[model samples]
Target: MKEIQAVKSSLNAVFAIKDLGQLHFSLGLEIAKTKKGIHVCQRKYALEILADAGMAGAKPVSTPMVKKNEKLFEQVVMHDVSAYRRIIGRLLYLVNTRPDISFIVKCLSQFVQAPTKQHHQAAQGILRYIKSSPAQGIFDPKDTDIQIKAFSDSDWASCILTRRSITGFCIFLGESLISWKTKKQNTVSRSSFEAEYRALAATCCEVQWVTFLLEDLDISVHHININCFKVP
Candidate 1:
């Protein structure tokens, strides 16, 4: 507390700055400090998005995307391209807190150039899913083991058009999730084993980058765990 105040005072001397006692909200993120830990979310931002999309009263779904058999990339093009692009931009920002929707968002993002009606409907499905848990956010627990662990997986040739594998991974600092990503691989893989190997390789690169980040922050990462699924 004293160190923070000292820094604030030093900054205030040179420039006009008011010391906000504690951070509760900033840049659309709602931060709440609780006895358990710090909980961060964007509930208000999410609600606004629902309202903008005219899905405020839409029924919520359990999942963000339909099953693999349901085609998301139909040839029927949407008329209002701008609207679809806007919603996708918002959802991408929301992915900062909602990792569950990351994979579907990645899939939907690919069709932004020439989005179809199916693509718009798929994007709306995401809105409905967000409506289910608008307040959902990442909780950083107070009690933690202070370790880093990551899990990664891949689906071979998931993209119907390109036949490229999609890679998904999440990194955890102790029990709290800190970072995650879902991306379509640039090249197609010959086998499922090759796809999974690529996923693990991507995960390793992410872990290495995260370790370097921690080192820069002066936080020692004693133990690091990177786990991937086995292809049977």
Candidate 2:
């Protein structure tokens, strides 16, 4: 408490300050304090997304994507490019607290420039999935181990349109996930090993950035371990 007061005093010397007390909501993220930890979610934001997509009454689904009928660069064109862009832009922000949809969102993002009916339908599927558990989010345990760890993987030629692989990784601060992404490999890879290596390279860059951010906040990690895994 003394440290916080000292920092507040210093800030007040140069600029105005306001203590909002414990955080509950900011920029669409809802924060709830609990005995176990801090629970973060965007329930309201997710509902807005569903309504915007005209799926508020839609039935919920268990998974974000349907494996058997997934859309992959379908040729059927959607004339309303702006609509597609708007929905995807919303989903990208929604991923702030919903990493489970990250991969499917990444896949749908690739077609924003030239979205098809199938692409839009696939996006709606994601909204239906969101309806299943709108309050689901990350739980950051208080006073837990602060170790840093990361795991990365790549799917060999996951994108049928470009034959490019999808690389994904998640970084954890102890038991809490802090950073993650699923993106298409910038360059084509010759084999699975090469693809996996590229994914690790991307993960390294993210870890470096996160480390620097933690240092800025004066939170230092003594050790970091990286693990590579096969994408199932």
**Model 2, 91: alpha-carbon shift in Å?**
0.5
Total clashing residue pairs per candidate?
0, 0
Please list the residue runs of candidate 1 whose C-alpha ends up more than 4 Å from where it truly belongs after superposition.
none
Q: Write the per-residue lDDT of candidate 2 for residues 1-232, one digit (tens) a residue.
A: 9998999999999999999998999999999998889999999999998888789999999999978354556687887788778889999999999999999898889788888988888888999999999999999998777788999999988777788998999999988999999989999998999999999999999999999999999998988999999634
Worst 10 residues of 1 by lDDT: 65-74
**Which residue pairs of candidate 2 clash?**
none
lDDT measured at residue 74 in model 1 versus the true structure, 0 to 100: 76
Every candidate's lDDT: 0.91, 0.90
Q: Give me the candidate number with maximum lDDT.
A: 1
